[model samples]
Target: MSSRTYPAWFHRVRSLVQDRKARGQAFRYNDDELPTRPQDYDEDLSERPNDSGDSDQSSILSDISGNASSEKARYYAMKEQRNERKKQLRDRRTGQGSNQSDDEWSEETEVQKELEIEEEEIRPIKEALTEAQQSPEENSAPLKKLGGRLFRLWSTDHVKYCTFETAPKRYIEFYDPKEFRGFKTYPDGKIDGHIYMVSDDMCEIDNFTPPKNPSLNFVRLDGNGVCHCFEVQFFDNHHLTLKMPKDLVFHRQAISPPSEAPEVFTYYGICEKYSDKLYRAKQRKEAQGK
Candidate 1:
């Protein structure tokens, strides 16, 4: 029994020594032993750890190469994540990043428009009342006067409130002044029953007599510088000619009435009742049922 035990124990010790060599071979893989090309490793795994056929330990080298490649892949993945975060930040800066729906924005604009209309609702009625209260005196108040300028309201059987500006013969050339109101807003001024041409310039007054038409107090400017001189000319929107003075300039509702027209020796065309309705050439034609 002792002799048998001795051989068995000796065999076991030798086998242990060979197994250690196999373990050491498997662990021999280092950084340099891996196949540089994948094709080379695929061609043949020629060095298994336990094989005795000239084991080259290629599997250990392959494991080291795979670990390095895995580390590189993880780095690229982290870089991609960082780039995505940067792109998100860039999108936020431009106004392109919108969170609310378009309907909400449209509703906000509509509310702003409604508020503007509400703000202007009271103006028209106030303007109408103010005009209604403007009496003849208030409308004809003297604006500051300068030399070579005349201001006055013009009234006629055709149209009333036809305001005008006139240059008298004394100061300057016969130019039209702008401080006159037009036919629409001359307030209530009237000339009735007949036509009259009174002006400072007698020749200009005589040159404007109608064909066989009668007129009253037709003359030149007396000591007061009033020009009864007038002409019958067509105005805009008038059916017939307007009896405007040649020296007077009438704007199309442009000039304000002068303060001096009422103070002068204004000639009346001898009417039965005091007529307050002023006339324009067109309006007179309409009133005649023409």
Candidate 2:
């Protein structure tokens, strides 16, 4: 045994001091002095106290979540209100609920109602019409009351002048059968008639009769409050002449198909009668059948 006894503690202390000196002399980094790895520091980090900044961030996140939830709730609430209003409007229109009422009818609805009423009354179209439907009589009392008289007007009858260039025009003047339906004139110069004359100028003529002698008749007011007159001369039952301030003549031959022919134009004629209530006139010899 050596005279000097080495204790276990003495060896440990000596080694520690030697190790420190060796590190300092060699410029070596100690394990504690070196940067710690993030993985290695994880446990220690967990043990550390929380900071105010971290708590603040957590609170902000919570606040943002709360605000988002509140906004969603408000959005849904407004959507529900809009849906309810739409339901009420729909219900009212369908008459599903008496409690719900409409503010007013739209202008289009009012106009439709008016149109329906007019169609019902005027019946411009009727179902299942037939040729056998009573034809207007030559001398119906209604026709007489309306100042209607049948007449034939001819410009020329000679075959020598039967060409359109040389031949005179012809027309059979009479009232429309529909004219017997009804008529009314308003103060505003508005008129409603089953057989209304709508031309360059509007007027309603009940009748036209020639004076005993050729003379001008009194001026009369049309539905538009416009003035009009007629001149007439009776040559005989077979012949006559007529002049109207306005062209209101409707041709008998043209009545059924109706005419695209000039309904309004200056008309003068020398006409002959086939009979008292009917007449014959020729535009061209080619139109002899009419």
Candidate 3:
């Protein structure tokens, strides 16, 4: 006969049970010492009073409300942290901070360079919506006319334009007279941002010489306080073109109703509608290929 070997944990548990039994305390096998279920075990727990002299319902409600408030607090805290991080990044980029490692500085520098390249690949289109908000009399006729409409990127000279090439659909909308929003809808994700726009004399690409045709210059300030300047090469009722640094050309077409403010201000609805369109277009193209 072979002796049975027990694991070390099993021996520990057995010793604990034996110690309890020696002390006349209930062990695992002591069913008689266990408390019996109350007759009202099936009754609603919410109707019972808790230790604090409040009904269980009140405690549960308090817990639910507390969880919701805590979640909201956490969300705002995260947002503040993100804003602070972005501020630090901007400060470092502008030579205000020197504490960053060489690798970190190099990485951020490359990001800034990429953003500069992307800004040059954007285009524009016409029709203003909130003329009263911006005081139409203060802006040029061309600037005022460029608001309140959504412009879709039709074509771009740069094949590697990140926003244009990656997104199945992309749009730029001057939601407010001086505020512009750009959004791109991808198959699995979306990107959107808003920035304030102002007129500028300096062009990113053609700083040495002025544009040959009558061109409108715009300097856009993003959340990170980075300024991107692009020249509006042409703008009309249906078409708008932009000239950017490195001689990048972006042509845009007006998609929404002319001169009318968009019904929905947020990008969610717009992106949803466009995403569906993109899906259908892809299906059609696949069918044609077959």
Candidate 4:
């Protein structure tokens, strides 16, 4: 068969189409081996400054990450140290085995231990001193023994003189040894009308204060039938005396006691004006203008 001749334009168009088809088939079949699009020089020039900026950002991020990791490690290490210290303290307090070193017990702790030991040592001494410091008034009475019924007060056999600095009175007891009827003159110049018996040997008086000597309580009935109380004490069994209250004061004596009778005035005491016969006598004399 004879081939027909195409026009030059048609042959050109056909050749162009066939070339395009071949190129498309080559691109589809061999996509992996295809040449990359050529880079634009202008675009590369424009992105050059961004590359440097990205590098700087990456370096800063790496540095921050490294610092954060280091800080985290330090924090965990400090936490472990704190926990160990707490465990040591708990073990010591609970009497458990402790891992603490000897340096943990400081000088202040040693001083505190020494002070505690000293206090314990002195405790008995402090108690003894406290007992010794108590007042003498709390002690028991002394042994008072006068050969059974040594002497008596206000007996007619004995002449007694009151040498109190305030009052110089005299007393004589009118006693009937058989009848037991008797009366005695008091330091205040009043007569004691009560007929009371005094044993031979004086006994210790109790429930009274100012515990210097053996003392007793004496009750007197005056002429008015009123009872008054007096405290009586004796310097010795031979010398019967009176004991006065601490608050009572006496006048000065005109004459001192003789050397031989140094304690003769010890029986004297401050006189009560209301209970004194001499004072009443003086008052009556004044009122009567005598």
Per lDDT, the best of the predicted structures is: 3
By lDDT, the candidates rank as 3, 2, 4, 1
lDDT per residue (tens digit) for residues 1-290 in model 2: 12122223223333443444432311222333221111211111222233211222233333333444533443333334333444544565577765543333333443443344323322311211111123332322221221234443322111111122111123334444455445632332122211212111223343433233322222232322233444444323333344443234332122322233332233223222233222122224437756
lDDT for predicted candidate 1 compared with the true structure? 0.27
Candidate 1, which ten residues in sequence have the lowest lDDT sum?
164-173
Clashing pairs in 4: 149-200, 149-201
Query: Residue 174's C-alpha lDDT in candidate 4?
Result: 23
lDDT string, candidate 1, 1-290, tens digits: 12232222223333433443332221222213221211111122223333322124322422343444543443333334333333333343455445533233243453443233323321332343244345342343332222122212122211222221111011111222233335222223211112222223222211111222221213232111234434331111111122344225332234444543333222112111111122244358877995
What's the TM-score of every candidate structure?
A: 0.13, 0.21, 0.22, 0.16
Best by TM-score: 3
Model 2 Cα shift for residue 247 (angstroms): 10
TM-score of 3: 0.22
Clashes of each: 27, 0, 3, 2
Better of 1 and 2 by TM-score: 2
Ranking by TM-score: 3, 2, 4, 1
Q: After TM-score superposition, what is the CA distance of residue 287 in candidate 1 from its true location, in Å?
A: 24
Stretches of candidate 1 off by over 4 Å are 1-228, 231-242, 249-290
Report lDDT (Cα) of residue 1, candidate 3.
10
RMSD of each: 45.0, 45.5, 26.8, 54.0
